[model samples]
Target: MGSCENQEFECKKQKPLLIEGPIIVGAGPSGLAVAACLKNNGVPSVILERNDCLASLWQQRAYDRLKLHLPKQFCELPLFGFPENFPKYPTKHQFISYVESYANHFSIKPIFNQVVEKAEFFQSIGLWRVKTQDFEYFSRWLIVATGENAEPMRPEIAGIEKFDGTVVHTSRYKSGSDFGNQRVLVVGCGNSGMEVSLDLCRHNASPYMVVRNTVHVLPREVFGFSTFGIAMALLKWVPLRLVDKFLLLAANFTLGNTDRLGLKRPKTGPIELKNATGKTPVLDVGALSQIRSGKIKVMNGVREITKSGAKFIDGQEKEFDSIILATGYKSNVPVWLKGSDFFTEDGLPKTPFPNSWKGEKGLYTVGFTRRGLLGTASDSLKIARDIADQWRTIKDTKNICNSQIALQM
Candidate 1:
């Protein structure tokens, strides 16, 4: 048993499993990115995933018609590119296949179904104790990649329990086919809400999209060019506000006045708002057309839920057969990772992007950057290189100590 071993973890075996590099939490894209980069640097890591398979949220929880909102180029992880044959915006299945190939290419296999109960750093020992259901993992570095969307944000609606209809979160929503021929109230205006309503319309369901707040809805592409790519290019030379103006102008010229239809624009520009608070603007695919066509009716905020329907703040009442909450997700880091100063109560790094990855006391986080997969790539590379450098220094120090002991003998 090591001197660091304590009553905190009475292992069946005396010693805890010491990882050679970092202990990466979550086998989602972010975790995989770190693991692959570590492997590239000849550092070994163990990935702990709570689910049975990788990308469980995408495969198990996401809707059937889901696809990457950003172009596939921006959505790819570190050290790998999406297949050249893939579309600019790949479908969910295509994306999953790419993930599998990426894992295979790097020979990165994660230990599945291992839920991390708690993780705390022992400063005296200069190691981290990563406790899971069955094993205790000790490592010099801990990489938290559980991600921003670790848990679904289920809002408390007034009289929700009394709502006598099919109620489910967007995570559990498989398809609109299940909601055919019913009046569905979708309580959001984000990409998911818009897409779900559009799907419902396709399935012959009456959908009322509740747009409670201002949203920045941009065309996924403008003039056959990726809107995001254009924004990135513009931001390099032009100011962010100028980029926002260009995007808004292009969106207005392309998509027409979305405000007239009900979804109003936020005073904060899309990119600026996204930067300030990790809120991503809704990238319009085909949902706006439905909203314009009046196939998807836009409604006000929900005031109260009735057994048969809902009463809006406008005092309008509509009978609905089902309610779909497209409320989005939050990080679950606070629930498991203990005694950490890296993350806030909301499970995001207190520090913002471009500097959010590396934390104190050998703690690192990926995908906490609101910047999405691009952020994952940046964090993964930096963390890998940093750990590799530190590992070499530690080995050199240990060798020096050993030589001193030999000389004394």
Candidate 2:
């Protein structure tokens, strides 16, 4: 804790650990998908997870009531499907079980608790230098699979520190039972925000959600068909506009006018808005009815947070016992990856999806594709195939089995 210890820690050096294949950073679904795909391609990779367990977001951060927004099939990783008995939309626990099984099935043994501090491609050495807490890895290929949502995106509110109430991000929130019958102010109107509010309502808590910007609220399903399913099926037949029109018409008929209920729709179509901006529309499970019945109050953005409650930008003040920030997450790629060419300042691939998976200098990105699991699968397969082709062409096996960390699987 002293200056001397800090200096020594900074001065400490790790032997350059050479990796035969690609070095993966992260052990989440994205990382798992790529690792599995790579194994299938006859190539091996080393996955490094900062956390002790795989899929920490799903295993630890997810709420008790969380379920796959999409069907299980659509959410499956690269080379695996959810168990046949698993429901169309598996619950939080079921998804975690699937993730563990997926990792085990692939024989993935990620070095746990190895936080990637920095990763840089050295043109001189023709390799990537990945520096973690315990290892400095050198490899011809480096895969950034941390994906989107690496870190919680907490908003900067005036007087937030002065608030006496228990304020926590959705990452830390597990259940509304934790708050009992307290008045909870839920910020953001995204899927997580809506679901969290719905959960609070079930727990007999008064939940107020904040709608700071325009959002698209579509029924999770429409007439025995999943809304997302319909969108995907229709996109192939018609243009995005027609698909959006049908969706809005269906939404208008099913949910009626949400504007009067304080949930405003964006001017652009849901699909269009999502394509332009990675903001996904809230797939209402039960929150719409709660909002309709006035069980969950919708309010404007907060102007300031007081000890008792928060003052809304609409010039209104209300008291609350706690605050739940469903403000969402952003990529942490920029923080550690030492480059500006491949990724943006916000930590997403500079290139868009489809093309976003591959970068120059043998660097690849998975899960940055706003397309969710489907995108992750696409990126993973492409990366694995490309790496396999390159490896076969080079036929470089001289350094194989040289590193202590061998590709066990």
Candidate 3:
């Protein structure tokens, strides 16, 4: 109803664009999935992305050796499946291409390089004001799909600032070839840690993994079927404890007591761990083999970083040429919507990860709550259906009001 002059926030002072449908943030898979679903339901939306293109994490940040942790069937977007010729577990590049095809197939267009600097809700108008660098948008609904991996979670270690070796996060790590013949230490035993260590080994680099806590190291496949496939089938029917027990049994049968190899078996099941802590176990490709063969060494938690390398808590000091932190990332929610009651002080949802998918007050979050592509697709469908239902109700109410006014006239 009003232009940029009436907006509360101080922005670039340009004419504001008003939108009826949701203004989705981030052009990644979660954002794209929700937008496509809304469009299919006859509700158009706008996407604001900070990156140059869609799925920038997969396209630009991921390592060269990255592949889908889950099978392709489980990774497809809503109403779109991976090509028949694609691998069961598509590589990072293949997945990126599929995302591009999904966007093209749906004709979804996003405003590129538009980073939303601020967002404010106006309850009286039932609209939200979202401001970027150059423009401001007001929309009826706001969907924050900025995702969890947008910011890397770097840990502070004593003397790390003084260390002279190459330090990089997994997102910046292109390939192991760059550190040829160098001794490297990779902190954290998540998927990235395993994969990066394996890559470093392939490049003739001495890599050590720092396992600071209990970890579940699972074989990627058993009996030629993905372990993830088995979990999907049994996770619903079986109890969490039972599933954990079964997976532990399977892990032992597949890879001998990995605890003996320095990876202490976590008391909790892999699925439960992921559900609770949002940390998935390492699905081994070749990292386990190298670890078992003594090619890839394992270390305890770092006591402190030295000028050359790190000293472990076990009172062992090792010199390394570089340290690669596969330490994962935290949610960037506070950067835009800080002090909002929907999130905690740390920017995590007040409701745990599961309940975070459905938000109140015309606000919803997609990738922030979900785990993978399948979860994103499921959340997007639910969100689109909810929005469509609300739209239908408003339209019917408006029609009835207009008819009553005509009769009075």
Write model 3 residue lDDT over 74-130, tens digit each, in one string.
Answer: 888998899999998899989999999999999888878888999878878877889
The model with the greater lDDT, 1 or 3, is 1
The collision pairs in model 3 are: none
Which 10 consecutive positions of candidate 3 have the poorest summed lDDT?
Answer: 1-10
Candidate 2 is scored at a TM of: 0.93
Instruction: State which candidate has the highest TM-score.
Output: 1
Pairs of colliding residues, candidate 2: none
Runs of candidate 3 exceeding 4 Å displacement: 1-13, 397-409
**TM-score: model 3 vs. ground truth:** 0.93
Tell me the tens digit of each residue's lDDT in model 2 across 1-409: 1111001233245756677789989999999999899999888788888998989998878999999999887898987889999998999999999999998998888878779999998989899989987768888899999989999999899988988889999999999899779999999999999999999999999999999998899998999889999999999999999999999999999999999999888999999998889989988898999998999999998999998999999999999999999999999998999964788889988788779999989999998999999999998999999999998866655455444246664
> What lDDT would candidate 3 get against the real structure?
0.86
lDDT of 1 by residue, 216-246 (tens): 9999988889999999999999999999999
